[model samples]
Target: MDDYPVHQISEVVRHVGTSDRNFYDRYYFNCAPRFDGQGQSGVDGPFALIIGLGQYPNLGVADAFAVLRRGDDHLVVRASKALGEDRMDTSVGPFRLEVIEGLRRLRVVLEASPDNPDLSFDLTFTADSPAHLEARHFDRSLERVTFDTQRFVQSGTWSGSVTVEQVRTPVEDHQWSGNRDRSWGVRPVGEPEPPGRRADPAETERSCFFWIYAVLRFSEFVIITILQEDADGARIVEDAVRLWRDPERAPETLALPEHTLRFAPGGREVTHAELVFQRRDPSGGLADPLRVECTPAVACYIGVGTGYGLEQDWRHGMWQGPLTVQQLRRAVPEIAPWERMLCPVDNLVRCTLSEDGGIEEGEGLFECAVIGTYPRYGFHGLGDVAE
Candidate 1:
């Protein structure tokens, strides 16, 4: 098997991260079955499987989880362990994530345990497009700050098998499509205090956010977009990339130097979005525009299962070796309710995109978070008061 470069391993073990208490390194991926032979409407899949692993160096903890969503059925398996001295060992209990080749391929394995006999998988991901790095800067006020963040995204295919309830489903290379992202830096994690004690008066007055990120894969090419807006619907950051893959050569990125995005009226439950990308001519002149229309079909709260924000007992990276997997499963309700709820920070949305005079559809993740006070989204304090 291939191994990650030495420098990559060094970076993983580097203990001198920023001083922020929220600093973290994480791996995230989502996979869904490809659309059938029919047209755009034929692109319906039964489920989406999302897996994540996070390491909090400052806190000396690491965690991992897998969430499977099929219609109304959502199953989650999570595990956490102490950071220990060896950060290079990316394993928590039966969960292990390995990089086969830097920026090219990865292997993810989940072993079946008595506590979680219903889920397990051994999968490999091979990148089909070049990784796209994102700009990271969010400075609204002294109290609300986000900085020093770095992220890269790639669209790929999965090969292997997923065992659910002992029923194995083979994922052939090209039969399933997915996206994976690696991010490091300061962000909110762990549980929050009770609502009464967590109120911040200044946050509710002017704090709101809207974010959209999607990677749509077509037969010949892929389009990726990431956009963010503040409470008043003012643009904070935006960018889009068009990746074209040729059968005989490496994929190329078409420079979309200019782009614009418009979200539908309702800020909370965003169902529609319109995006236009403009490439510049060799002489730096504006060229014809390419437009994409999007509609969301399903969404999963980032805080649920993946553990962006949850109570201490249910949070990602929480120690889990004390209890058996089955005991942990039985204690889930004591930590939080199982019903679907909207969180302020992140959400993974499966959407359909229409472009290029043809309607090709795929699912991508989208996140909208308004951190301080924004009455429009019904956020009154630090928590998600909107729902």
Candidate 2:
């Protein structure tokens, strides 16, 4: 398969295993071109990622990044040994280590090798350089490694509040029989409640309605890779950039258009962007999970920012989603005593930045204000936000 085009990777589900790490056996990278940096290298492929559950591939690939660079050609190394467990003869007095430049850097706190505890290497590279990273770079003499990204890769860093909001669509539920009468043919009925069609009595409900919300917020910057050309313009990348705060350093910014950046002969700012937050719901549960059809898909606006070029307001719930308490009780008439509270996201309370670093009033009232909030879970009644 060495003759296969690099693009063919996506066409086939290649299998890789982990000897040292514990998670993914195969990883996938969705490659795209962007003038977003130092023009296209035409040689270095974009930093595609582990296609699985996003744990190990990030680690192994990041680990492999330390050894390869833009100019190295046909470098065959062992991935299982560099990432996998102790298959190599470590008893031979500490394994050899090599440092390469124009590569990537990872912070190490304590050394691991039994023979060489103080092993340290300063892997320095440009802000974002094109480097070929694969686990096999560290140990070369072996073929077909037991490659698993989880076995060797460690999670990255995390900081800030920038986030991504996916649009939710309203799907149809087969549960909707549409008849106002009970499917059981109960003769006398007052208001029109949708017919219940549950095969088992336990599955039936009078009506099931819940709130779905999304918000936009700022987040920390983790990985920022950029390249400067001698006379050409600059290009900016979104996903390859890292977050310094989170353990995984996963790029909070999703994929965006490739941009051509200019350095003014030679210049770009050394940046550190801080994150702020807003909210609708952060728990990340689907608005509706039972339906089977092409539902609505729009960007969530609950936590968005103007600077980031995301001001999407999904079609549903744009105008007056959940209303006052009177409407809720009137809708079902099942629980009259339950009161609703609407506590606004008060900036005064949520934004008092003291040296102690805590919100004084953001933890405002749940019961005192009688605000316009209608909580659905755990707190069916009022006094849930704890004032």
Best by lDDT: 1
Q: Assess the local accuracy of residue 384 in candidate 2 as a C-alpha lDDT between 0 and 100.
A: 36
Model 2 C-alpha lDDT per residue in residues 37-138, reported as the tens digit of each score: 352223343111111101122123211111111121111111121232322211111212222221233211112233222221221111122221211211
Ten contiguous residues with the weakest lDDT in model 2: 176-185
Supply every candidate's count of residue pairs whose N, Cα or C atoms clash at under 3 angstroms.
Answer: 5, 69
TM-score of each: 0.77, 0.16
Which candidate leads the pack in TM-score?
A: 1
What's the residue-level lDDT of 49 in candidate 1?
77
- Shift in Å, residue 185, candidate 2: 52
Off by over 4 Å in 2: 1-69, 79-121, 124-387
**RMSD to the native, candidate 1?**
5.4
> Model-by-model lDDT, in order?
0.64, 0.19
